[model samples]
Target: MNVAVIGGGGREHALARKLAQSDRIETVYAIPGNDGMRDVAEVVPEIGETDFEKIAALCTSKQVAWVVVGPEAPLSEGIADYLEGRGIKVFGPRKEEAKIESSKAFTKDIMEKYDIPTARYKAFTDYDAAYSYIESVGAPIVLKKDGLAAGKGVIVATDMDEALAGLDALMADSDAPIVIEEFLEGEEFSLMVLVNGDYTHSFEIIAQDHKRAFDNDEGPNTGGMGAYAPVRHIPESVRQEAVDQIVGPMARAMVSEGLDYFGVLYLGAIVTDKGVKTIEFNARFGDPEAQILLSLMEDDLVDVLEKVDRKEAFTLTFSPRYQVGVMLASAGYPGSYDKGHTIDFEAVREKSFVSGLKQENEGWVTAGGRVLLVTGEGETIESAIDSAYHNVDQVKFNEGEVFIRRDIGRHALK
Candidate 1:
């Protein structure tokens, strides 16, 4: 089978790499792919997500059997709908369904309507009205832009003053509308589901991500610093409940609304004493997270996507082992940063547990602002983290600095 992956980022690179390993796959193509992906797949320069018509034409011309979208922007713009309309098999939610991620207000409204557990929120287009609401809602508030802002829109204000200030930044300064929500306190975890309308299959839970740019979770939000899979913090039972109550029902709700959601459903969840409530919903896969999550998946990714597109019942399996990834980024990331710098990963050493187990260096290259993802796999979260950081220490880049959360799997360790 020939596959075409859309988008040019570490997530797409990870997807392209995974697809290339499939025995059923004949050729893999990436539109505007980064330098790192050139090794695993043929990089096409002319085609991009914005050129939907040209991309569709290329899919037809190349005899591409499946199209996988890796980013939210194109999916929110309805690339999947366009491809499926042409009788092409594409993995992603339709535009109408994608509004769940494209518009924060829309997602909050849906959650309220369906009684899906989530933070209390109020949408505002007027600054005064928003500020008044924040004053009433009190301190430790959460502010979010109605539209996507490349994973940097949401702000957790530590006090009433900060909340008011955030409202000004999002509503007064920015062109997009704002959503002021009541901040909920708890441990956060990411849950992703592969869905075909009402049918859904869940993957292993992971808890590795640096939302803030600075260490110790202080500073502005970022796209993501790093991520890992088989999160130890979330118990298996709790993870399953989240899928059953949140992800499954949400997909079914979209289906009921005449939107056939066929792709990845990323749920940013908060585990509280009141059960799990959704922090946000992403129509596509999470970055860095996909890098580590997919690395540990034992099942064939291509087959899983095909089954979802066909709306057929299929069982997916995951390795019992845990996976961790540390992202090496340019000095200034999720902000103004340098690019085109040379990177080196040849010094990284790989470790293993089982006898006869051999390790492989996937090679290193500059692909995005966040240069590379160093991943490690092991039987336990502690072992996985140890291996991942060991490899991360060996990588070198010119004028580059990396930041990662120290408590990636702290909950699991407990």
Candidate 2:
């Protein structure tokens, strides 16, 4: 079977690699795939990921059996609806379902409707109203742009001044509405569940992503600095409760609301002292989290995704070893930074997943904030982190324009 994966990032690369592992899959195609995927799939750079018409045409022309939508943008833009309308099987949620991620306010509203456990919040279009509410509530709150802003749209402000500044910045852009909410304190983890509209599904082994840009959870959040699978912080009982109270309810609620959501339902949650409370919902797989999850997966990904499309029942098996993925980002990442720096992936020994790169006569140069994610697997979390960083050290970028967190899986050690 021929498969096409949309999006050009670490998550897409991981998907492409996992698909290639299926003996049933004869060929895999990536639309504008990164350099790391060159060995595993045929990269089609002719059309952008959101170009639904061309993508549909390509699928028909190549007789591609399945198209997996990776990033949130195209999904939010109704790419899945467009492709499915053209009779192409897509492994993603439709635009309406994708609103769970594309619009924070929408998800919060659903949470409120379903009695789902989440932070108290109010969505605001006016800056002054938002500011007044924040002042009334006091600080240590979360300010989120109601719409998607990559992963940089959120500010966990500890004071009024910071809250106002974040509100002002986001409100300046009329397109960006803001959500001010009470901040839930606890250890956060990523729970990616595979669900059909029926609410029947299975959960992937839990993986935790470090969102802060720097070491020790300091600094502003980036897309994700690194991730590790089978997190110890979330005990089995807690995970099960999350599945029953969070994932299951969310899925059933979407169904009740008349949404046909299929594919990955990414739930970002915190293990609070009171219990697990949702942080956010994403329509697709988490980036660095996907890298580690795929590394530990023993099941044929194509089979699982096909089952998701068909809403069939299946179980997932995973390797026992821990998998850690450390992101090597551009120096000023999650902010303005230089691009087009040359890189050499072959020199690195660990498995490298490229998130951003452009091929030139000179070599592959960085094209996005996060350049690459180098992953390592081992019997222990310490060993995995060691392996990941060891390989990360070998890869080089021209002008030393890359910065990596020295303590990716350090929390696991503690």
Candidate 3:
């Protein structure tokens, strides 16, 4: 079967790479793909990520059997609805179900309704009320822009000053509401599950995502700096508890709510001394996590999804090796910094699932914030981290130092 992965980001690149490895798959295409995917996918550069009309037309013309939506934005924008409307099968949820990620308040509400454990939060469209709530609750609270911010809209305020500023910044826009939550302290790990609700079938794997832009968990949050799997710090019991207590309840909630979900569900949860609690939910595969975990999958991604669609009993397999990935971002990413650096991705493409590049003069240059990913495998988390960083340093970028958190997997060492 011919498959097309929509969206041109690291997640899409990783999806394209894995699908290309499938023997059951005849062809793989990446819609508006980047240079790193060139080895594996036919890059359809003319189509935009959300260009539904052209995507359906291209799918029809290309005889694309399945369209995999890689990023959340296109899913939130209803690409699945359009493609499915055109009689093309899609491996993603619809727009209404995509509210799982598109709106934080929506998820919070669902969690509340289902008695799912999560941080206590209040959604506010009124700036004064939000500011007052922060002042009343005190420091070390999480203030999130209720809408999508490319994973950067969160402000973990350590004090009243920062809290107010964060609220002001988020509420500066008219329609952007804010959600302030009581901070829950714990080590965070995310589990990605292919969920087709009806309580039918699901497959889950856990990964630890380093969100802080700088080392030692400092600096503001970006989409994610790096990731490794299976996470070593969080206990297997706690992770299982998350699946039974959190993941299960949420899936049942979707069914009861009359939402037919068929796609990836990223359950971002934290292991607290009290118990496992949800941090957030994403509608599709995560970028750095996808690059790492998918590389470890022993089964073809196409084959697994197909079995899930058929409601067949199947076990998703993973290599014994632990996989790690470190992101190389433009020097000033998650804020503002550099771009247009001439980079030769040839050296790292094989070991990486990269994005944020454009070909010019037969050379590549940084086009977005998070540029590339280098993945490495090992029997231990420490060796995996070592392997990933070692390969990342060899990437050919004709520019000054790039930003990377040196302490990505150090928690495992601790």
For residues 254-292, what per-residue lDDT tens digits would candidate 2 score against the true structure? 988999898788989898989999999999999889988
Candidate 3 lDDT, tens digit per residue, 199-282?
444444688888889988899999999988887566788878988899889998998998988998998888888899999999
Off by over 4 Å in 1: 204-207, 347-368, 399-407
Order the numbered candidates by TM-score, best leading: 2, 3, 1
| Candidates 1 and 3 compared by lDDT, better number | 3
Best candidate according to lDDT: 2
lDDT rank, highest first?
A: 2, 3, 1
TM-score of each: 0.91, 0.97, 0.97
* Model 3 segments more than 4 A misplaced: 200-204, 398-401
TM-score for candidate 2, please give it.
0.97
Clashing pairs counted in every model: 2, 0, 0
Q: Enumerate residue pairs that collide in model 2.
A: none
Error of 3 at 34 (Å): 1.1
TM-score of 1: 0.91
Model 3: lDDT equals 0.85
* Residue 198 accuracy (lDDT) in model 3: 58
